[model samples]
Target: MRKLGLGLAAAALCAAVPVMAQETAPAFDAEAATQAYMATLSGAARAKSDAYFEGGYWLILWGAVVSIVTNLIFLRLGWSARLSAWAGRRTQRPFLRSLLWAAPYILIISLMTLPWSWYQEYYREHQYGLSNQSFGAWFSEGTMGLAISIVVMSLLIGGLLALVRRYRENWWGIGAAATLVFVAILLMVAPVSIAPLFNKYSPMEAGPLREQILSMARANTVPADNVYVVDQSRQTTRISANVSGLGPTIRISLNDNLLNQGTPAEVRAVMGHELGHYVLNHSFSLLLGFGVIILLAYLSVAKLVPVLLRKWGGRWGVTEVTDPAAVPAAFIVLAVYFMLATPFTNSLTRMHEQEADVFGLAAARAPDGFAKVAMKLSTYRKIEPSTWEEIIFFDHPSGHTRVSTAMKWKAENIGAADIE
Candidate 1:
């Protein structure tokens, strides 16, 4: 009887083990834990947090509306179709017709948006206590941005023209792939060169926080030469850091606000999250995924455009597609396509951010830190979103999701030691 009882007890123990392990896993609840901590703090912390989000949410909404409305108005005006028709019909050189049609929309629409875009950026930022940059600074930045946009858009339109002229129906995928590569190249280079134009960067000053951050990087096998801190305080009060560049070009960078104001744990937490982005190849994944989307979407447009042109071109007074006036129509169509596709893109992006959140918690050993950061970012990022809101608009994990994960992690690893 005793021997039989022992055997049964061993079997029971074995059966319970797996369930126990699952229950005790060190998952993150950084979000909840931090909010709980925030709940404990006084008035100033809460106010600062609230102030952080002032312009971000509304601005994004307004910007999207403006983008769509502006494009729609242009399209409805038959501007592009008219311009393109005039150019295509008048130009003796067929080769130059599309370029001529595209040129006007490129110049005018950009000019149209410049004043409002600049004001929205400058005023909204100042209103939120997020920026200290002077008008000259803002203007200079805007000018550079406009220059880059023109270059990139020209390249993009030129490539699209190539596909439309030759492959026609099959061009969308190729064009999308081209866009991905172009963007990737831009990302890989911009951080090292273009970003420096606006702000000064220097090695992180000697400090315990710097030492600890470096230690974490080493432990993670991140080959960073030295950490850089930028004078982002010249522009904004918000704090951030990034691990930008690839291979030899890789730079581990943080803003002056991060160094000056953020707590050591907070800095570490955010850096860990950015490092998570690098370690996980989030950029690459996004680049490729976005490429696929562009390819597929453009293909759908390709399919739809020809039919629509055949159906409505005669009525709209446009003959061939290479019309300047049709540029507005095409852009509007593309905008609609992208707007409808937002849910899928947002979902994919959220997943990537969540993955980075996990990696950050592990790497920083500071789940609580990320949770607190969420409270801060809530000023700009949504703290919580309904499922539908998350699906349609957010391209990153909502603060609630981030904090909850952090809290869950804390709950599981309650005994884990805080960073030194």
Candidate 2:
């Protein structure tokens, strides 16, 4: 979602794709292997994980519906019109007007969605033994997130409005470039500026693991001097590590969950996968991929909004894309687009993840480690989703795919003296 245009609306999920290699692979029994992994979970854990992941499928459907419906309601109630007129009356400056208009618009939408957010992020998490946060702490973070969203959306909207006013006939091209630049800047600043809002990041304690992580970063040309540990146990038990930022801001960070819950081999495997993201330049590739998606979304809006307005513009008191009041209706279109594009976008992410798996195997030389970590991930993710579900819903490899890849790697290189 951080990479997606709507910023917070998109769900960050995971999936799998098969990997190809020169070595003849072992014919691992995927179904039996998946069954073995599922057997590892307790009856309660299995039910809960199944319920949580499966419930997520429904959440996706409902989230899109809610987003479109919410925006439509705002337009129908004339809230967008009233807010736009108020901002117009108060500000003569274009940027200031856009900022003024965006503040309330974003706040209204956030407030409207608070109930769902609470249920999804807070209540459900606690119910599942995943959350370590108190309600107050969760609320505080949510508030901070909302504030940041307001500032970001305001700036982005101001720029977009200026572009639209300046190049009404062909703003899509210019708008796409600007959108790319904005996202680039956001990624650059995120590690240093934005990430600290919710969690404290301290240099990881001096130890072999830190040294190992730094070495991986060095080998990968990641430009990171230290491994930072984010205090994520304060919120959830999902284990993770990431190579975030780019260029001068490049940094490697791992969540506390990974340190506490993962074995040393699992740690290396996960770190390898994270490092693979940076080493393989998946971030920029993903940015470029999502950028294209965003471009198409913007172009679709540009092409369709005029026609839509012709049909219902008078009813909502909206004239065109230039009008600040048109934001809600435009949002409805974008949200629908986001929903429709999920499978395509998700496939792109899954492919990148599979490549990372291949790279992780080579980099960490910990095939068993990778396999165990993949099973561990099954604590939250459905390890054996149907093929179509995996294609449509996941952004990272499923456990069966990952474990099989690791098994194949082991089969090919079982007696290698040195993986390092």
Candidate 3:
């Protein structure tokens, strides 16, 4: 999610306190409004939309250019090696040889970025009124997170190096594509495995609301297996739910906070949106689109890395992918590549989100429910924006736009959408 207003909105997925009543504000019917808005696009808007849809050609160019520049700079500075050495030296005075062998380049990068997780969870989140976590809360979470990151990054780095060495000039591009596929697999399965490491989950106890939720699932053909509620309240207090997995593995999971904080209507609305994702097969489509992007990235990386590495590797006091210092340079390269591809990558994701919004309305059969769900998110989102702002920044429909959609649907279905 692009956090339509700010990155702060993402944390809204995790509630920090128990549910409380909110002062009634407004309705948000995203489905119909967005469809109407899409219909209203003209000239440049249509072209830009087409460009985004057809594949953001410019993003590919930017990804290659950024990746090249980042690698050149990182390798030149030998930053990764120094940072790894610095951490090892401070923590245990470990011998440079041992640290170099044991920690590896990727491990060092992960270590250095530890502060980011801290800052985001503790400081930035608090400032935004989204995180109520205490110091101890943040610390324990950070330690666990570090452990996970080290393991994941090490494997990614190791796999990438293996490719570079065996495949030579072709490795960079192939590796980039491989990374995209790897990430998609993680997205599908990780919530089941990785999320548990951070929180607890249990089946929703038997009850009317719970039954209604299940009934809705049954009514809509959503799989009943794996419907679970996670103890998300252990960390923060925000409402969330999701429809995850593919095929028989599919499941509907909700944050306990949603159960506690949200009204039944809100819960249904949220689930309806998630169900929309399920019916529309958002993940499958996204994965496919991402694969296409990966191919584009790989082609660019293959042509660019060797030429740049041969020219600049020695200057960075590193010549190989395994070099600790070179790892940071490579990370920087990858970051730039991913970042430059943002508009393009994000466009695909937004399209899927839009599709789900429409599907949610039809499946949930409750524009009002969807409307309220949007209201809950208003604090975390940019409620309204100029047309250009939406095209550029919104990966999800804007709150106002979402509400309008719901209203439009109500108008067509019932002849009047009285709620604002």
Specify the highest-TM-score model's number: 2
Better of 1 and 2 by lDDT: 2
Regions of candidate 2 where Cα sits further than 4 Å from its true position: 1-38, 224-226
* Clash pairs (backbone) in predicted model 2: 14-394, 14-395, 14-396, 15-395, 15-396, 15-397, 16-397
Least accurate 10 contiguous residues by lDDT in model 1: 20-29
Model 2, C-alpha of 66: deviation from truth (Å): 1.1
Residues 193-269 of candidate 1: C-alpha lDDT, one tens digit per residue:
78888789788777788888888878877765746888988888887787676556667789888777777888899
Give the alpha carbon lDDT tens digit for every residue of 1-420 in model 2. Answer: 212322222221211322232122333444455456556775877677778888888888788888988888888888888888899899888778888999999999999989999998999888887888999999999999999999999898889888889999588888988999998999999988999877899987888987887787788776656468999888888988777787678777889998998877788888888888877888799999988998898898888778878888898888867888887777888888988998989899999999999998988888778888888787788777899999998888887788878877765565578552
- Best-to-worst ranking by TM-score: 2, 1, 3
List runs of model 3 lying over 4 Å from the truth: 1-104, 246-248, 320-325, 415-420
State, as a TM-score between 0 and 1, how close model 3 is to the true structure. 0.72
| All candidates in order of lDDT, best leading | 2, 1, 3
Cα shift from native, residue 93, model 2 (Å): 2.3
By lDDT, the better pick of 1 and 3 is 1
lDDT by residue (tens digit), candidate 3, 312-343: 66676555554434455444545666766776
Please give the lDDT score at residue 49 for candidate 3: 38
Worst 10 residues of 2 by lDDT: 6-15
